[model samples]
Target chain A: MTSADETQQRPAGDPAGPALDRFYTVIPAGGVGTRLWPLSRASAPKFLHDLTGSGTTLIRSTYERLAPLTGEKVMVVTGDPHRDAVCAQLPELDEADLVLEPSPKDSAAAIGLAAAILHRRDPEIIMGSFAADQVIAPVEAFQSAAREAVVTAATGRIVTIGISPTHPSTGFGYIRRGQALGVEGAPSAHQVVEFVEKPGEETAREYLDTGDYLWNAGMFVAPVGLLLQHLAAAQPELHAGVVEIAEAWGTERQQEVMERVWPDLPKTAIDYAVAEPAADAGDVAVIPGHFTWDDVGDFAAIARLNPAKEQDAMTVLGEKARVYSDQSSGVVVSDTRRVVALIGVEDIVVVDTEDALLVTTTDHAQSVKQAVEALREKGDSDVL
Target chain B: MTSADETQQRPAGDPAGPALDRFYTVIPAGGVGTRLWPLSRASAPKFLHDLTGSGTTLIRSTYERLAPLTGEKVMVVTGDPHRDAVCAQLPELDEADLVLEPSPKDSAAAIGLAAAILHRRDPEIIMGSFAADQVIAPVEAFQSAAREAVVTAATGRIVTIGISPTHPSTGFGYIRRGQALGVEGAPSAHQVVEFVEKPGEETAREYLDTGDYLWNAGMFVAPVGLLLQHLAAAQPELHAGVVEIAEAWGTERQQEVMERVWPDLPKTAIDYAVAEPAADAGDVAVIPGHFTWDDVGDFAAIARLNPAKEQDAMTVLGEKARVYSDQSSGVVVSDTRRVVALIGVEDIVVVDTEDALLVTTTDHAQSVKQAVEALREKGDSDVL
Candidate 1:
């Protein structure tokens, strides 16, 4: 494996910090992001887009955010179709660190494969798995929380960075924190009681009032060998399949083994395959994340993250000069390189792409998935 | 002058009947139709578009509607820029009958030029001036009403077609019909008391309840000599300029005379220059037209005219198969040859053209003119 010093040619605005020893960042770069249709098509998913108008793509931002901590120890696991796109967007990623899945088998298989590969290379390595399409603010805070999670994971426990709830949002699952672990160098680390599914409005409010639940942002950190052992006990078939593929990862049999085993791996999220079972066994710990984080699940969430300056001003995600709005408030995702004019439309969302255009309201942002489904039913595979 | 029989090679679907002898139809085609922007621009105005999706352009439909009444004696007066497009769309128009204006000098100048030329050729000929961008249905009713108006005009009266009001619409001016003229060939012909401007909502409702007011659709019919006489009395300078141009119309000095006098002609609508003053003089007569007529002013009017089958369905003006709507109700003018997807928007008006896009609502349809004004201010003449 290449040393961290060799990959430390950092960009100007990147966070300057010392690289953590034995720390590897694993990014699960998938999900079609259907709620952001026309802008987030299956051919070019959300991870590949600069959705926040931040000049860099979401995956690129993810890589930049973690590069100071992981350096050359970063790996990305994505499906075959997006392998080239992922590689193109992230040129610094080593060929050996980019894992191309033969087929999608949900989070458990994708993340588990990365953990098994890193464990095989360095048994004592601590790996943190983060989604490539999420947004986190205040790099210092995120780095601090990640450091605590890594420290907690070194004690042979599966660690997750639980985001502190800013509001009673029902869009994300909740993690209920129990007693504090009182471990050295990790003050906020606590034993996780359970992982709960997304709740109703009233239940979400109740959870917020109790102050025990934190938004489960799916950020997991643990020793690579410990995660593989948990996966081996909970999902033995999926674990064995990924381990077999990981064993031939850098060899001539890598492609052959991936094709034979990946297709048969269990199609399940890591939460269902390992996290919940590990919490039941009292092996799960959580470090409360003080930094702001958002999954950017829909345009409404995106609007919330990047709000308009005025109350009724439109939030544009592309060239601001290309959009003209009058008496309208909402988000506009413009990539068509054409002028988009909105008049007297309140809370409207306009997304302009090359082949298709979407006109909806921020309230109907989630229903954009149905539009993608309708397109699929109509055999619009070119756009899909 | 070409006789009616010499110009009777009408198309199949045209109103089939004997052409009215000594009658001429003068269509004034102008107006940028800025209210329907992106779809209607200066280069390609509303009259040139098949807005109704009825396979024929608005001007061609106007020509087809009046073919039975005017035959080959039809004349279209339009701006010089649109002369070639008009001739291309209307193949049957005689070269001598297509009057090209030097520039847009409003309806009075356009119609006066046609009348002066027709009067010079045949003094006793009856002429009817109609707009090229209006939609009138039930051709037989329109023809019958037009024939009566022509008979009324032969009596040397400035005859106009007053459309019977279907609703209390404040978007159109009203003509108060007084005592009947009781002419031999015209039964529904009445003396015009006055021509009122577009009224307020309450005034419009009162006008509809009175049963004495009819919508002034700007359809005027009169003898060519009588119309020239009215113009000479009401707008002497405009009438003199058009007459000078008409005198040199068939001569080699036609372009020179037009350039010398046309720009100096009064830039006024026919209502102000002729109809209003003529009504005040008690020289105007109206023939009540029972045919349905629509100016197709804005997207709201278009939505009302072409309502979707379902209550919450989207009304598409282009390929309906290319539009996908879910929980939305509105009008979509998709001329870009791309798929338009609407999700959870109500009363939305989306106009997609090749160069620009407009997203507004039915309530803000009139404000689209503001968008055009803004684009013009930005010097986006390519779209304007």
Candidate 2:
């Protein structure tokens, strides 16, 4: 087989790092995924779906991909609603690893909760955090890169893995890489010059052309001490609250402290509350990773990762469709129960769920959040 | 309600026709609707749909619109399979008026069948034949025009109602008027100069700019003898065969003759076989009618007939949707069964059916036939 074809056919968990004795991979799997309405409802978010490839649910794929680096050391953080689905999908995770938040909280609190529990077990342990719904390929390459990033983080800098930009995509925040720190065989690490959120298409194109911007893939390799220190500097109250909770970890009082502290924690993205501040403070570093990656942000991106046909590449099966294209464009994803036929259409994303179907050109996929916002304004929580 | 609205309201039978006469509106309803597919299926053809106002089906509406002209004098010619649906929609028509053809021979054969049937009842009977799926306003105006055309037909000319063109439309054929016939207190009657097939957009625009051309609304007023005579002069074999079938009317031999003769018919349209030839012979008359009329040829035309809102003029429902230009300009029909949200979309026909949904720009609706042909090629007879 050709190298490209072989790369496509790599079995899950094969050709990667040895199972580590002390490494833990914590998946921050708790997100409402409201941006991807209908398909990614609160009941079934991105991770539960086999969105990336055939027979590979996003969480299942994530666990299998990470297994080579941290076998039996996987933990998932979710909330009360998706807790069952998460555990049911990953039954191998023990009860202690299934940390459930009593309410819907932001990623900062969830990560802080995971950190508190893991620190109680081993204060100096290195924890590599990954999101549940991401497409990272070339397993061997990813494992090697993760190992290098973790080692760099062990030396005290908070390490973030930045994916090479394949397109000028405004959907993702970008990491501007600074001067490199030498790491043999692995791509060099750099100081994160700045964090730019969802730039305009023209700006994204410029970033792609410049060859300096990396997509913030949201994967972090850090020692608990460094993450807590960064959090303390950025959000002193959250840092103190998490520290007090960690000191009282495994107790009912710890749960009380968490419930009291989390609501008070500003409902801000990690990019704003921690990553950006750390980078500004000159303590944040980004390691360039060549592993094929996708954030699967919207239906269009998901459609791209699992190319359907020629013009019609579908991430999911649609009934009796012949997808032909002039270029790698157009996607038709519908439940196998119904047939969706597309013809002479281009650059459009069609996602069909049981209740609601979305048909938008890829250029407007990011504005699908607008569709959700419209739905919420009309009080359509059933679809939201 | 206004008289125009009342005329438009009746979807079952025409309002001004003969009182409770066993109306059998002969619906020549068997076009491939290649210009309007996915929504317009072979089994459910365009004529069988309620393409205009709510509740009034095209066939039913046609029956009502023509009722003022031929009260209880309606007969339909359709392929055998669609006979059940035709009857289900208009229960007033007797089974005898529902002449079923073995195959889709063409419009000429279909109309010939109706002519033969009418000849058997009364050779002198004035037949006002119109297509079953037209949206015509001002019932009183149409009734007055029909009465005039019937009188004109009695005066020995094959009378065709010509609509004054509102726009340069490449989608329809054009009729040019010759010398004006001084008709009293009525829309002017004229000698038909010539019949032109669909012209180029530029030519259509020129024709629209000139007031002499009228849209060939396809409403023909004729006595059975006059049509038969025209047919005899133009297509002698068909005329002779139809005469034989009429002479052996309501007999088993008549049915046998029809079965044999229809299959042997040249698969020509009426315009090609009779109307165009009659005009060449200088024996056709044209009457300009003032009533509003639409053929509802495709989704775009259907959208045009819908009520306009804010000049954006697309028919829109769904509180969650922020429709910018959902006037009748681009008909978007979706069931309240599901929330259909459209954003930044315009001039498109988005139809959500129970089994299949079609989303195509109004201009592209003409290509919907390709979608249907694909379904038919795949033996999706149920959908087709």
Candidate 3:
């Protein structure tokens, strides 16, 4: 990660600076993240935690990362329960810039609402939709890509910052890249051929070999009007609902209209409602994001994001974690002052929180959701 | 275990009951149990915990198991640190009956001092030394074996209640059984044999098949005078230190004398200082015990002692533990109100305490001692 001064000293693409003036980074903060359970919870989700063991929370880092590029031009779309927490963690965020959802309706509604509201604020505002819980590094590279993405977005095309595949991971969806768009400031911009679902290991490995596939990290930068235009064409009912709420936003009728129509918005992800269809219609472009990134998908992903200090040792995490490991190789996440001892276990993950503890190996980290689901069924929702 | 009423109604051996009148059970509550750490601390130790989820601690159960036979003739020998805990747990125990060692000198000094004291209490009293951190079942069978051991001890032969081998376990020493001794009323008594160190897997299997070996539980039954005589010959310096302390016991100089000599007493296990030597001298006899027993040596041993409800599942232990597991088989011990969720790990062990946590697997449970040792080296003794 580069310092703020360093990033300011080297504005990614100096000439692309004017393009960011009309750009607003829309942070869609949501997801209980059951797969990262015990660490990620209903009341306090993934974005609220410092999953990387860095001093700052994921959402705060997200805000910090984009602040340099977009200045104070940012809006956060999150669930109602997390409003106060989001406000507290990112104090610079104004209450009015926070778009609190009545309930989750997935990516389509969450990001669409943010785009709709930003579009209302400024019709031609170029908006970048970045989830609050992703881990990214090499700030300069990310900012460089964002500049290109903003430039591409201004070309009346919905642009996504697609990450290059580092492994044959089946955990994320893939985006097939096409010929470069030859946009002046956004030289890396390519036509997005299509977006594919998460594939099997064999196919994922094959996708890696092609050098044409990038991980669809659900990040998008586009003119708010273009995003809303696509949503209006593909999900008209959902588009009308978000448009109504956006029109009433900041007015005395904001709460009244949001309570009336927000709950009934189409529950879908942006990938299905807009990105995919837009790609087919040759309206979507991709900017290959060269920066390292992780969604903190699960403990397995966490293992990769934070490598162990030793060659064959567990990755110990926490602000006050007292860990002692011997002849072991795995991951230990402690949220308390408790001393965690890991001995002779490979790829194991131990997550210790205030109210709950989660133990599993990296191989079986995905199964953690099963335990959470079982807890919910057993009325152990308090821990869940 | 048989109920007190049942055990009382059916005396193990009616004639042997009278012999228990002069029989005193010495409870050696020592060993920090580094292998069972987090659950067992320097201040708490393994003896202080109820590893079996039986609602009673190992020490308390040891006392209760022998109470029906020895009445109030029970003495606990432990380190000075555990004085309050041992006293609080066994309120029925007399103050004088609790022998607090100023420092650890291993089993030789501990059990030797107990025998020396009991000898002064009653020269003719037969003493049985039992550790306070082992799990045992079928009180009737255990009592029956104790009865036979007592009967044999009355004959001036230092006797051992050896547990019949249940598996080819390499975790415990093997007592190679000699030919049977034609002692009436003590049918299982065998002639003097040899005490062998823990054997290799193949050797253990061979010993098991031969039906000539029993797990040396380190449980000894002998007349106090005879026990002292053997200790006097084998560990003369240690024997003298204990004798002088026993002489000063109940007098004003007791504390002064113990503080002066106890620390320097020879630190050797009773198995090496007495049992093996006694067996070589043809002065030791074995009483084959048919009851289940475990030293609770490590989390792996804990896995065996407390099997999971499901065949392929983890063993969850703790009175107030809130654990949810899925597709994982191992051991989980939670001492706090924290809910523990286990998923997709085989033979894993997760121990959560107030200030410490331990994650491993049954296969590498013994390696926990290495972790504890590392913590000690790091000077993190507070958690230890």
Candidate 4:
């Protein structure tokens, strides 16, 4: 039911919804999302799903969210299997900007490849790489943050939009913001002290208590050349490979180069390959993102993104889902037209698809992958 | 995939395998069974489905369990909706012995009508009324106990097979045993002091502590005339209505009489109309049954009856069900070919049907009816 027109509409006179003459938005759309199995699968990843029951799928929403700032300067990097789905969801997308990977790689290769291609196009253009499967609310706030990050990135710093921690969540990595950068057109810009791994419960609580930490949402706004420079230093082989592919991109050799070299690229998340190392070298800047964000990591996160329709009751997704919840508080994501009835269960998560069904609780949402693993062991590849 | 031939095999030379010339078996196959919703619907009650994956449906198993003793004298009384399914499951069942009720009625009406009809056929013959949805193990033991009950019932007493309580369960009613009856060939027969209602936990524990209590599994064997005599005394209106229907049975007036009188018949469980009243009048006898029995009351009881296939794992029913359990223990009753995967949740219960799916836990199995009630409130009658 979602309209693609939402991605084309630009708010007038909005501080960040104006022409960003030399800024491009790169969307890295990859992730098997096994934790959301049955709803999300290897054949069709989470980015292609409207997990929140929102009209648009996650990737479509991402495209629309970033469209106003980048206009036609948007690029989506995805795996070969999702090429048609991504194109179908983003009809306005230019073929020249849609990067289809030969196979899945880590965030570093995906984002690095996009940056290298953008750098080859225009060395001075500032590019922001955002993941395709995350959800953010109050578009204006995120746009304002992106505007600030873009402005801060113009000062030769790799800027990242850090989300203010809503809770002491141990599932996400933490970004420590240091002194204010005092940069032009960016009041919230601060120097990054360090990028920390997911913390233990005690340390996370401490981080929340001190209020000096923000969740590293893996959003990067930097001059394409600066990101490529950092990538070349931290992951030389991956950088060389993506650069080799980028050099032939849009040429007849594009698919040939990607298929030959993509698989051997060093697989690493963008945080480890660039952000963390650059933070250690004092070459990273942080822009606070006041907007709500979630990676749509698992059913638990999906429930958070799509709050319960009734207070403390349930969050249900799917256009044709007929769910009757009685004395139950949980999440139900159904793709089929079947009626799902839940009674007297708290914090439960039920994912119903045409071929498979998953039943667990939010407490075990992270363990959903264990079921997927078991299915793989049993050679139930049809479901996988 | 379950073979119906299992319902025809009779153990040769078993003590209760043959030669009960004047006995008949009455199988009462009724009950909406909302607690097992999606699996057992109002259209197709629990007795019509093979719930235990035991190669025979509940009613078919009940029929076969008593076939050795009663031979061709078994009569099944059910609502109109299940006529075809019942006949399909039991091809050997004579059409003359199949009694179809026009609508849902209480046990007193279903079994009492069967008893009244059998009374009209041969009042001197002993008749046993057994619910079609229960499960019993060690058929020989149950048959022996039933043999004793029939011999004891021959002495003009209403005999109930009282299963020895294996645990302090508050779900089933208790039958308090008094002194031994000392009847020949019925060595375990005893006087029933009373038939108690389902007790509270504390009282049930107390009943278990003392060995005088046995679970009243609603199995009653008696002379056809004796049960009707008690029924006529305790519930005169229901007795008259069924007796009127029986009078016109097998004639052109059969359907006309049942349609006119069945709906308005006094609705009452047979236990209240006969056994409890007979016990009060010191006309009831108890026969100790040393066999495993389960009413398949709810998912919890179902999980117990169909124990987990793997240790501390799960119990899954449905021949085409593709289930992968990982670090989870639960019960899955599927009627479709869906792959049901469970993660870390324990004691979960999932029922996947073609149009409806139910997710709960054994702890809340009884509350499944609440979902059904909610669905009814929403006027979702098609799935109901």
Off by over 4 Å in 4: A1-19, A52-54, A119-124, A155-157, A164-183, A188-215, A225-257, A260-284, A307-312, B1-19, B165-182, B190-215, B226-244, B272-283, B309-311
List where candidate 3 sits over 4 angstroms from the true fold.
A1-17, A163-182, A188-215, A272-283, B1-14, B164-182, B190-215, B233-240, B269-283
lDDT of 3 at A306: 86
lDDT of 4 by residue, A229-296 (tens): 99889999999999999999999999889889898998888888999899999999999899899888
Better-scoring candidate (TM-score), 2 or 4: 4
The better candidate by DockQ, 1 or 4, is: 1
lDDT of 4 by residue, B186-296 (tens): 899999999999999999999999999999999999898988999999999999999999999899999899899999998788888898889999999999899999878
Q: How good is model 4 by TM-score?
A: 0.86
lDDT for position A323 in model 4? 88
Considering TM-score, where higher is better, how would the candidates rank from best to worst? 1, 3, 4, 2
Worst 10 residues of 4 chain A by lDDT: A1-10
Docking class of 2: incorrect
How would the docking of model 4 be graded?
Answer: medium
| TM-score between model 3 and native | 0.89
The 0-to-1 C-alpha lDDT of every candidate, in the order given, reads: 0.86, 0.70, 0.88, 0.87
State each candidate's chain A TM-score: 0.93, 0.81, 0.93, 0.92
Error of 2 at B169 (Å): 5.3
**Which of candidates 1 and 3 is the stronger one according to lDDT?**
3
List model 3 lDDT by residue over B1-384, tens digit each.
Answer: 234543564456577755666788899999989899989988889999989889899999998888766777789999999999999989878888999998888899999999999898889999999899988899879888988899889888999998999899998898888889877779989975899999999999999999999998989899998888889989999899999999999899999999998888888988888888888999999999999998898899888888888887678888888877777788888899988888777888899898898888888888888888889899888899
> After aligning candidate 3 to the native by TM-score, how far in Å is the CA of B197 from where it should be?
5.2
Better model by TM-score: candidate 3 vs candidate 4: 3
- Worst lDDT window (10 residues) for model 3 chain B? B1-10
iRMS, all models: 0.9, 3.4, 1.0, 1.1
Provide the lowest-lDDT 10-residue window in model 3 chain A. Answer: A1-10
